[model samples]
Target: MTTSFIARTTLAVAAFGALALAGTAALAGDQDFALLNATGYEIGELYVAPAQSSDWQEDVLGQDVLSDGQQANIKFSRDEDTCAWDLKVVYSEDNSSAEWSNVNLCELSAVTIKYDADSGETSAYGQ
Candidate 1:
């Protein structure tokens, strides 16, 4: 009886784990991507909005800061059908900002933001 109980519990746990993985797969969408900060400053705020949007959305980073050479996961629900996105970052050290537009999140799963304070320019690279 003890062996049977253990076997059933193990099977149930395995099934639950499979369901959890399926749910996670279903939640991943084209808008989900990794955001890498190669900028020379700590990012105090990060915003992502559809390219066609007139105004930037709420900061995706919230209270968290993305330090230089760090990465953050930017996820969107499966219902997000938009592919082209705009990104903006605000620096923590001086509050200077940078922006990128028309990034295709569907074709690119990762993005890196690079900044040059010398010329005050911002650029993005992705794969």
Candidate 2:
């Protein structure tokens, strides 16, 4: 595998075991995926919740910081079973944040979050 792919895989594997033991256990039919941070900031906290939920589930990143270009694997419980979801990323330096709404998690194996300084826009695309 390529170096970057190896790094991402290593991170994913490291996170999977730790996160599963941290009370976010995996389940059948879970929407396992990768979250790529292309936002050029250190992501302090990451939150994911169903589209209709008012509150986020939890800090999925836990104690980890997702630096620019780093990717983390996001695993969910089968009980979640939601197609639409919301994602929020808080930058570590100043707590500045961005949110992406109604992401279709069901069909996505990876989601790339990007920020454009010129437009002051943050968006996500998944595949």
Candidate 3:
């Protein structure tokens, strides 16, 4: 009888552990975001902000991540600039990294750092 009880207890603990691991995996899946950039340019810096707020939350600069042919939907807004644009990016496959210094994407609603893409390309709404 004692051996049976021990076996049951072990099985119950194993089941609980499995459940915990499954829950952890689910949470981890939800935590990732897509990191998109322009076609030619790699990601030099990234910035993010809350949904309703104007202040931008800057990510670590000079840390290149997005490569060519890769896309991600990172968080951004036009709160800093007067223009209200939707910031979208696409990394070009031709470039190794983007020019972080000269590119001020504040005016673009959706900025695409293309390898051969022009710097002065504007969106419809001046974003």
Candidate 4:
């Protein structure tokens, strides 16, 4: 084989590899997810953080409120290797909050906030 032919083939292979990596990155956050508010009050703050992170990131709501019985899209840049995440929501009425730890964002697409009116307790589940 000619040297020129081998060089051209190597360049083509490299280009193909770069394109494959780009395609994989574009698939991040492909599946849609939402948060359902069932706390019997408005949610004043919503936060999502990686399970390994020590501090919570910014509030996703940003002055918006998720009213009772309302569902809002929870858009995030999902890491392919990490599926666990933490979610927190604070109520507008009394500043009471609920949190979920090590919630798997990969398998679960929706998170519902559950409240017990009788016990005055709040919790969350992923589905």
Candidate 5:
């Protein structure tokens, strides 16, 4: 190839690589939030997933449990264009679970699970 053509091609490739790196960095930007257990019971498992996903991700708590009135830090990365998320938590005693759906992570700093003794139901909300 001509010297000018080769030089132009190399410059273009370098620019492309830089843009790709920038995009990757943006997509991998830090995402972290606190999970509060206010359901009047200990939380055994915590799962988070993108709103579009059908399956819940692995437990964020791992071997740890979030006791009532306790909070745990959860960290993850989401696409820059995606802001919706889902959170699920299971109670320690009976494996009963509660889920909060379509939560906008951009507007949420914490997730709290609430349980009602009268209705025997659990609900979650973002704060």
Candidate 6:
């Protein structure tokens, strides 16, 4: 009887452990991608659109300005836009980062940004 009880207890613990690990994996898989800004600009607006689409999705206002060393995490979804292609942004001193779905945004070949201080010079970067 003692051996049987011990075996049952061990099995129960193992089952619980498996459930916990499965839950963690599910949560991780659902996570959305985010853009990290370490510059001094306070983001005013953010936009995202597919590479093949001409329409851009305007993210809601109110974002944390990425200070020289601060970071913010955003959530995104493809259903929020019309094109459902990729991601883009138009920010100012007030807005900071835009979070969107469509993993292709992270894989952009180049990103262009127009800065006010640089007389509207467009800066580009690769993923």
What pairs collide in candidate 6?
42-93, 43-94, 43-95, 43-96, 44-92, 44-95, 47-88, 48-88, 50-85, 50-86
Give the alpha carbon lDDT tens digit for every residue of 1-127 in model 1: 1233222222112222222221111224756889889976788998888766898868889889999999999878536456666677777876666666666676677877776554445667776
Tens digit of per-residue lDDT, candidate 4, span 8-121? 221112222222221212245743469999867788998877665888879988879999999999776655445556667777776656666666566667777766665445
Better of 2 and 5 by lDDT: 2
- What are the clash counts of all predictions, listed in order? 0, 0, 22, 0, 0, 10
The residue-by-residue lDDT of candidate 2 on 60-125, one tens digit each, is: 899999999999998775486556666778778767666665565655678787766655556666
**Candidate 3 lDDT, 1-127, residue by residue in tens:** 1233222222112222222221111221232235434443354444443223454445423355666556645433323332121222222232222122112223222333333233323111111
- Model 6 ranges with Cα > 4 A deviation: 1-31, 60-65, 80-86, 94-103, 106-127
Between candidates 2 and 3, the one scoring higher on TM-score is 2
Residue-level lDDT of model 6, residues 42-67, one tens digit each, is: 45555554444556656633454434
Top of the candidates by TM-score = 2
Cα deviation in Å at residue 21, candidate 4? Answer: 27
Total clashes for model 4: 0
Count clashing residue pairs in model 2. Answer: 0
Name the runs in model 5 displaced over 4 angstroms: 1-30, 77-81
**Model 5, residue 18: what's the lDDT?**
29
How well does each candidate superpose onto the true structure, as a TM-score? Answer: 0.72, 0.73, 0.31, 0.71, 0.70, 0.39
Model 5, residue 6: C-alpha shift (Å): 67
Q: What ordering of candidates by TM-score runs from best to worst?
A: 2, 1, 4, 5, 6, 3
Q: 1-127, model 5: which lDDT tens digit per residue?
A: 1233222221112222222221112233343678877767888998877665898868889999999999998877545455556667766776666565555655566766666565555555556
Model 1: how far residue 93 lies from native, Å:
1.6
- Cα lDDT, model 5, residue 51: 62
Q: lDDT for model 5, please.
A: 0.61
- Model 4 segments more than 4 A misplaced: 1-27, 30-32, 78-81
